[model samples]
Every structure is written in structure tokens, then in C-alpha cells.
Target chain A: MASSSQIDLSGTTYCVLTGASQGIGRAIAAQVSKMLGPNSVMLLLARNKEQLSQTASLCESKNVKVFYESIDLSKASLLEMNFALNKSLEGRRVTDFSTSLIFHNVGSLGNLAVDTARMQDVPELREYYDLNVFNVIALNTQFLKLFEEVEDRVVIVNITSLCAIKPMSGMAYYCSGKAAREMYFKVLAEEKKHIRVLNYSPGPVETSMIDYVLAETVNKNLRDVFNSFKNQGTLLKPEMTARKCVKVLLNSKFSPGEHVDYFDDE
Target chain B: MASSSQIDLSGTTYCVLTGASQGIGRAIAAQVSKMLGPNSVMLLLARNKEQLSQTASLCESKNVKVFYESIDLSKASLLEMNFALNKSLEGRRVTDFSTSLIFHNVGSLGNLAVDTARMQDVPELREYYDLNVFNVIALNTQFLKLFEEVEDRVVIVNITSLCAIKPMSGMAYYCSGKAAREMYFKVLAEEKKHIRVLNYSPGPVETSMIDYVLAETVNKNLRDVFNSFKNQGTLLKPEMTARKCVKVLLNSKFSPGEHVDYFDDE
Candidate 1:
């Protein structure tokens, strides 16, 4: 049997990716853009205009059309975000493509200074979850609505984490958001049988998120563990992990709504 | 070995129960109130003032002081709700009791009229999650903060559901909220080793929630299943399930953060 990584995605694709300015999302945008057949479209969304442009440039291909949108996913209302998404499409129909793909990669490891006992700030929690959970739900909902008549298949990927299943002591907001988002997609998968939904957990990648966790997390033990991952050279690079993620999509053997981790053998 | 249902909880207690106006919450409030020792404090919280008063009366005991607070958990900010909680406490210290307990039972099964694909209204989603997820987190945080110095063990019980672990079609909001809240409490359990955390999945109880699900859920298959349960008289009575819940707490042999379902063998 051919390995998942060796399997190539063949066809013109319409892909929507969030957090495309940085880290795994940018890498995925670049990698997948290279893989998509002629006349494919890539819509990259993030808050950083300059970085998003950089990502779009990296994804530059004569065959693949790239569009970058700079919008704070956390700040915008669902309607506003939907409008932005529609504007990005520029009158393109999802059914025109052979495949409809969406990568829900935008998330935040919230202020780790507060543990569960001290997480009493309601607005903060709301904002955090808006970015991490609610926005994902809204975008996914919009994606389904827009691509309901897709030709081949609709692939929805949530950038999930082991934290979605396992609780880390000081990371309540992050864990809960992941858990909620993961479950929402699971339900979505069950409700819409035709669409493919996967919770892809990109393991300990060397992202700015790791740096934020190291600097901000109140749990010293967890901080040290992350520090060790950094020092021990075990942290996976963003491009490498992103490659694996795309490979998983290409391989397409995993069960619908299944959580596929980077470490899990194909 | 003694069956879990046969075990009894002893000593004076400080108990905080939310959603105490009706259904499983009211039932649990009444049952647990009867078990508490002399001078135990029973603080019942819910939006329905008349119903909350009724629950308080049901939990009435000369030995146990029952206090009821009327607050819309979904509307109140964390600070406001904490103020309400403090006002209800009326200068009573949590440490005065031998056991400190909290039941996070308040949740909503959101507007099931819309499927996951149509969950586009951001404000509606926010309000739903405020009641089901965020308020629970705020209250649980306050409970931990208040009961941190209790003399004996502090027990935190989340009135969870099978939906927390299972994907229910057309019930995206409820399932996601439960999953998030369960994971939050699990993190709390891990962080605070001295406290007992239980995610009790009360099986298909005969509550207004069941009635709502039967009436409003968009998925006919799920609605049919609930209708079958109701028609076949297989739905669990609130009080009976409440008794089982108290027994589980009293027995307390399960691992910390374990999810105990009513259908599971003792």
C-alpha cells in the first residue's frame, strides 16, 4: 500500500484556510497550493495583512489563484465575517471546483496567568471562546451553506489538539475551546453524512504559540516540559507537520469526524 | 463491597446548587438537603423566583438553612453573579462546614430548530453558551475560590449528559457546551487534587429538557428516539436519578474527574 504522504490530491480545489499568516496554517497554505491541480483557488484569512500577503506570495502559482483577507476572526460578528468571506470569493462558485476544502486553524492559547479557580472574568472568557470556538462554528456553518452543492466532496478540518481530550492544569480556556469545537464538528460530521470532517492535532510544532505558552503559562511544570521539547529538538517544524496534515487529507482513510494526531501512524 | 447507591454522606455541609428550580436540579437539591447534617447551608440558585422558593421550601429543614437566589445566570456577568452569591451567603464562611459542595446543573439545550449548518447567528450562540458553558465556568471558579479552605473535602458535581461524550444530531450547542464544561471541571479536578469532581450523566431523565428536546429538535431520528423513550416509560424519574447521584457522591470510589453515567453499573 502507498504511504499517505506519497498520495497526491488530484483535482482543481477551492480551499479556505484560517490563521494563514503564520505557523502551521501558512505552511499548509503553501504546501496545499503546490499540490492543487490547475485553476485551484486558495483563500487565506488572518489579522496580519503584511504576513497574510507574505503567505499568499509563498503560495504564488500560475495555476492556483490566491486571495488573502485580513480580518480579526475574534472581533468580527459572524455576519460580518461571512460578508468578508463572500467578498474574498469574488463571485466564484464553490461548485465550480472539483473539491471544497476548509481549514479551521485559527485559535488562541488564552491568558495562562489565570487557572480555573481564578478564571472569573466573563468577558475575557467570552472573547477567548469567540476566537477559538464560536468563530470556528460560524465559519464552518457558512462553509457548509456555501458549498452545499459541491461536485465531489467538502472537507472540513479543525486544527485540534491533544488538549481537546486531555486537560492541562492551567490551560482551561484553551482546552475547553478545543473540546467544544471538536465536539461541534463531530456533531456536524454526524449531521451531514456527505461532508468529511477531521480534527487534526498538530503536535508540539515550533510556533509562536509555543513561545507564548512558555512565557505566559502559570504552570511551571508544563512550562518546563515545553521548554524541554524546545531544547530536546523534538518540536516538529510547521512545514513538516503541515505536510503530514495535507497527506492525511490526501490519504483519506481515517473515519469521518475522527481526531488524527501527527504522531498517529497512518 | 457496598453498592454506591447505599452509601451516605455525613457532617455539616455548605452546598451550592444551580438550576435548582426544577427537574433534576430541584430533585438533587431536595435529596442532598435531607442528607446534610445539622446547620448545613443549602444555597439554591435559579432564575425562576417562585419556583426557586418552592425548591427552597421542598428543601426546608430547621437543621439545614436553605437560601435561594433568583438570578438569570445567562445575563449576569461573573462579577454580578459573584456578588449575588456573596449576598446569598450572608456572611457565612464556607470553612464553617465540614463539607463543601457545588452542583453545576444549569444548562440550556439551545435552539434545536437550526442544524449545525445554520448556526450563523453569533449573538444567539453567545447567549446559549453563556447559559450552558461560560456561566458554569464562572460559578465553578467562584465555588472553588470560596471553598478552597474548607476543613474537609470539597465536591464539585457537573450535571452532565451522554451528549457530552456523544454526538447528537441537531443538538450542537448543548453537546458542545457539555463537552466544554466537563473538560473544564476535569481540569479543575486535576489541578485541585483535594477536591472531588464528578461529571454525572443523568440518563434520559423525565425533565422539561426532555420535553423541549422532543418538541423542538430538528432531527426527526433523534426526536423519534426521545419520543420512544418517553412512550415506553423508559425515561428516568428526576428524584430517582438525583438519589443515585447523591449516592455516587457519598460512595466516592470513582477516580477523580471520572464521568459516571446513571446506566453504568455501580
Candidate 2:
């Protein structure tokens, strides 16, 4: 493990995030806006324009600039998206923004709307991978490529899930997606020395994803856990989780590339 | 770990395998055809109809029934495939096939056609996941659901790779997809009690994929391994790998839903 580098805020910094419309993503967006410099730029992309617009409004800062895209990373072509991103990033030069940060908070646990939810080769499971894994890789690459030429550091804070390390009964697709993501970062860490990658699994947080599990899931154990989290308020707050995740990513003391869980005190 | 169930193929059996046109898949198809009882059905599916037809021709055992489908699993709807498969299996009842098995050998490491390959979000990577991870899940589910009504057993032999467990400098997508797949099986082991899943890492074999890696990969370490394997004839033959994978999958002594690497003597 190498010494982690600090992200300089005084210089204009760019923060790119996915699933930035709601839940942990929204909370992280608001926190990032406040933590980054006054003139820092944040590009928030998600499926819902309404929620994203609402989130953009919530991240209101005196000097920080925020941009939102309602595009779907899974469906959109990487070439087209990269072209548009290159145009948007052309406005801000590499020297101007000393560092660029990325937070891939987007994740899917598959469709739990049906009580008959069980693992079988299904189209929905593939969609789940697209939402949770493919989009994450594709979008991450878009940003990494965007900052590839820059001499300054580019850090990717992958908001991984605990299920990545542990096998979940019903959410195989989601668990698998996270596992893929974690491994991807591990390779990125190994190959690209200049860039930093962090696999941060933020246990369970009070988010809309959890609400979905509680409302629609047929898996008794997961349902029980979510119900308990809701009833007992055992789930961590998204704001706090966002703060801790960002802190772990930007701070200089932590290792450059490693799997760090929120529950782990270290 | 729970006790594993042996797939009894002395009675009527059905074996469905992907990437059956060549390499380990073709070998597995031939091996399975010979192992199963007379009149047992074996469906070989892959992209190339010509190669698949040739492979199917070779699997012509005296009593074994060989079938081939050139349908693209990555693009086709699993639900539709399941519906069609259900119809196909309707002619013969569950008792007709004492044990139904699936060997998912279809995988893609992506085009190592260039030395310039490096990590960045590309459409090819997403396509690779679609081919490797998504289709495997979807197709596996279709068969698992197909055997749900029967008292007979269902076993899925997922032909995994070493890349799933280790991170490679130039092959992030392949590693990530395999990781996702291995995790999926782990969850399947946890959830599905009746259906058996084996994460069988085939290790390095003398396949076309290896040829591409050796010729085009810029990664010096991987190139060296491929070179050594190619020159020294150290790579395990597809026939040997297929035999080991099938042996582990069928025998009841092994633990249920275990990730077994080829190098592991177990």
C-alpha cells in the first residue's frame, strides 16, 4: 500500500457522480459541493430528471457549480456520452482543476416487486448487472478517460456494498455486480499508479434502495433486516455515510487502493 | 458447506452446454454425451452454427441424442428461451430425464487484437459482460426453473476462469465479469437448496482466447505465461479440463456450491 495523496480544494476541482438523484447519491452530492472549492464543478448524472433537478437545487452553494444529466448510463452509447463529456470538460482546463473525483454510488438489487423472487437466469437479472455493474464501469471509464491526460490525480471512490464480500440469499445479481466492481477497482489500483481507487462498502444505510427491499422483497431474512432497520432506526444515515465515505477517499492517511468497509473501525 | 448430490445419468438425462462450438465446451459436450445413458439428450449452443454443427456431429454416441442451437444467448430474452425450452421438454416428462445438467462455458476476455488496450469504459467491455455474466445468469435460471417441477436434480457446472479470483493489469473487464459470476454462484448456493451449482475454474487451457492473449496482449506478465504455456505445451488440454470439471460437478463427495480452482487437488 502506498501513501494516499490529498485532494487540493483551493484549485478548481471537478466531482463526477452517478445515481446522484436520490438516496446516498443525493446526500453525497450535497456534501461534495460543500467540501470542494467555491469554484469547483460537479457533474451529477442519474435516471430521473425530476429527482436530479431537485438534488441539484439542494446542493445550492454560493460558489460551487453543479450540472445534472438525466441520461441513462446503461442504455447510452459510451462514444456519444464521452463526446458530450469531453465537450463539457473542455470548458475547464486540466491545470485549472487540480484534481477530479468520481463517486459511483449507483447500485441495483434487482426487481424485488414480485414475491416469487429467486435466482434463475432471467432478463431482470441481466438488467440488474447493467444498472449495478456495467454502467458503473462504463461511466467510470468515461471520467477516467476524461482525466487521463491531466497530470493531476484522479480518484474514484466506488460506493461498494457489503453483499459484494458476503453472499446474499436472494440478491445474487446485486451481490455479483458489487463483486465485479470491487475487482475492477483492484485492477485499476494495480495498473494505474497515478490514479487512486477505493472500494468502500457502506454497510446498510437508510436509503430508497432499502425502502424498496422492505416494501417489495420476498426474501424473509433480508426483509426482516430491512424491517428492523426501519422500525429500530438501526440503519446509518446517508448524510453521515456520505461524509465518512468522502473522508476515507480524500484524506491522506488511508492507503491508495484497498477494500474498506464502513463497519470496520480501521 | 452442505453435502453435494451426485447427478445420476444412468437413466435418461439432458445436458445443455454453451460455447459448445470449440475448446473446453466442445470437449465437455463430447464427454457428457459419452457419460450419460443411451437416448440422453445433449443440446450444444454457441454463436457459430458451422462449428456447433461440427461439434454436435462429433458427439454422436450410439445411444446419445445430440442437439445444437446457434441462438445468441447474450442478445436473446431468457424468458422467451425458457418458454421455448419448456415447450421442447414437454414432449418428454421430468422422469424422462433423471438428471438435467447445464455447462456454461461461454466467456469472453474481449479483443486483445491491439497492444493499446488499457482500462477505460468501452462498449466492448459491457458487451463482454453481457456475453460472459448476464447470459450465464439468465440461461442458468431458465434451466433451473425448467427443472423446478421435477423431483429429479438440476446441476449447473459454471466453467469459471482464474481471472475471476485474481486481478490482471490489462484484463479488468474479464476479471470483473468472472468475479460477478463466482459471487452469483455463491449466492445461488445460499438460496437454491435443490439446485446444485459448481463454480469450476478451468485454469489456463490451450484455447483460441489464449492464442489472442499471447499474440496481442501488451501485458508482459500475461504474455510470458501464455508464451510459456504455448512453447512448453504446459497448458491443460481442453479434454482434460472438461473431464475434471465434469467429474467434480457430478460426484457427490464435493461440497455444494463451492468455487473449485483446477490447481486445487480436491
- State which candidate has the highest lDDT: 1
C-alpha DockQ of every model: 0.72, 0.42
Task: Extract clashing residue pairs from model 2.
Answer: A120-B141, A121-B137, A121-B138, A121-B141, A141-B121, B39-B63
Candidate 1 interface RMS = 1.1
Residues A116-200 of candidate 1 have per-residue lDDT tens digits of: 7777777787888889988888888887788777612678889999999988888888888899999999998887766777899
Please provide TM-scores, in order, for all candidate models, with all chains considered together: 0.94, 0.85
Docking class of 1: medium
Off by over 4 Å in 1: A1-8, A78-80, B1-8, B78-80, B87-90
What lDDT score goes with residue B127 in model 2?
A: 72
| Fold similarity of candidate 2's chain A to the true chain A, as a TM-score | 0.90
What DockQ would you assign to candidate 1? 0.72
Kindly give the number of clashing pairs for every candidate.
Answer: 0, 6
Off by over 4 Å in 2: A1-12, A37-39, A47-63, A67-90, A114-130, A251-257, B1-4, B48-50, B53-63, B76-90, B113-126, B218-221, B253-256
**Per-residue alpha-carbon lDDT of model 1 for B66-163, expressed as tens digits?**
88888889987767667866776779776667777889999888888987777877778788888888888888877777766761367779999999
